[model samples]
Target chain A: MSADTPPRVPVLCFGASGLRFAVPVAAVAALDAAAPAAVSLAALLGLEPHAAATRTVTVTGGDRARALVVDAPLLLRVLDVGDVVPAPVALPRNPAVLGFARIDDELVQLLDTERLLAAS
Target chain B: MTDLRELVEAAGGERPAPTAAGAATTPCVGLRTGGRWFALEAATIGEVVALPPITRVPAAGSHVLGVAMLRSRLVPIVDLDRMLTGIATPRSERGRVAIVRAAALELGVVATETRGLLELPVADGAGAGDGTDDGAAGPEGASGASGASGGEREGVPWIAREVQHAAILYAVIDAPALVRAALGVAR
Candidate 1:
């Protein structure tokens, strides 16, 4: 960790559309059960939804609360704030992404839980 | 097969040529509409977007082709060719939407294809037929600008000026004025 880097924070890691995704662990109220309400991440990202292995991660919110479906799970890891790079303007515009995080030599897109649920 | 490129080429616009000495230039995104060449100031453009599935709005008016989700914001799509010439643009993948923002209003205008940015020299006089009172319409000078007028279109007065590059004439659209007219807001 460099002097300018922020401390690591807990994130719920998962996979969808063959890409790794992470959401602030605090935003996830619970996991591994049918959500009261949910929207497929694939649908929001405009990608084909995986037919199988769709698991729900209930997100924290009120009135507009919703869940995110992750096709599979990767272990949760503490990601450094400095490791998350803001998305470049040229990338296909999606409001749900906060940025990208590098973990285990792979790029994991950090999801904005509130924006994701609001969009759903 | 339709020669899509030629069909949608900006009217009267020539391929870019060398800049004239001492002539001021402005960057613009060249586009074709109603068989006429038009350019929008590149600064006014927010981004270039693919033609998304526009949700048709009921009774919104002919100028309104509906709205589409652009980066999570629902932006109204106006058929510039239809708005300017009253002729519907044929639907094709070649069609592109230029997202423009002004006066706090962001909307999308469909064009044949964006010819990127070109540095064009301003014309010395009023545009050939782009004057306000003459109501000189473009090649497709059909009729009616909107339901508001009989012959003149709201965008007519908004023609800031004209520019020529490579022998092609382009009417520089006034971004704010265009937005106001599209929203039917009083100038």
Candidate 2:
């Protein structure tokens, strides 16, 4: 990549409560079968609890970790840093929201695993 | 009080002779929502456009419907009806979005319709008042019901004052306060 080009990072995208969200691949330690003890990502985000979570994503930050349950159809994508823009200043500050990026003509809320785990 | 001529002169501008019958006016954009009339300062409004598809944001306040990409910027679309009246704006009633900007913040406030631009007479030394005057004259086709009774409702300050134009009352929105409220920023 040219020096002027922003670096692209891999992220795991998933759905929860009918909304799309993503977290950096580096923060995801494992993707495994759904665990009954896994916390609902939708509930953590203050959305209605998902009826049934099909998978469990193990995310880690520093020495802390969390098992977040999400709905089906998870996908992986690489996003350019420059394409990720901060949430509008008028939006209420949410610690888990790192920024926003448009992928496949859809707006995705990029998450910071550390902040998301801390907020939980 | 300093006269308008003196204020104009101090600003390095030509001072035109004042007319006794001319009242100061503020340019505003008239909006209709939930069958109620409202006006926002024109200077604070960026534009009014047809409603666009919105992507919901997680953890945002209930008043926030979602965000939309307008002019390559992610602008949060807020439900003014919900913010003031606790009623979510139905999709059938939302036809336009008013892009309002104040300080470093911007938002798309949902509207049922736009009444275009208007020049509203400014009340002299008018502070944002409690909207307690139930007898205020309303415009044609207006419901004549007051939605809010004071400068603040449920601790959120929004309306600057009620202005009468063509025998109709338009709640002049305090754009900065509304933006702050949407951001959940303390006064």
- State in Å the error of residue B127, model 2: 9.5
RMSD of each: 10.9, 6.6
TM-score of each: 0.46, 0.81
Q: What is the interface RMSD of each candidate, in Å?
A: 13.0, 1.8
Clashes of each: 3, 1
Name the candidate that leads on TM-score. Answer: 2
Error of 2 at B66 (Å): 2.4
Query: Model 1, B95-157: lDDT tens per residue?
Result: 788887776677788876666566654445435343322222232422322222213443486
Task: Give lDDT: candidate 1, residue A98.
Answer: 65
| Tens-place lDDT digits, model 2, residues B80-154 | 888887787666544888888786788999988776445665645433332322232334455545444544343
Q: Report how far residue B46 has shifted in candidate 2, in Å.
A: 0.5
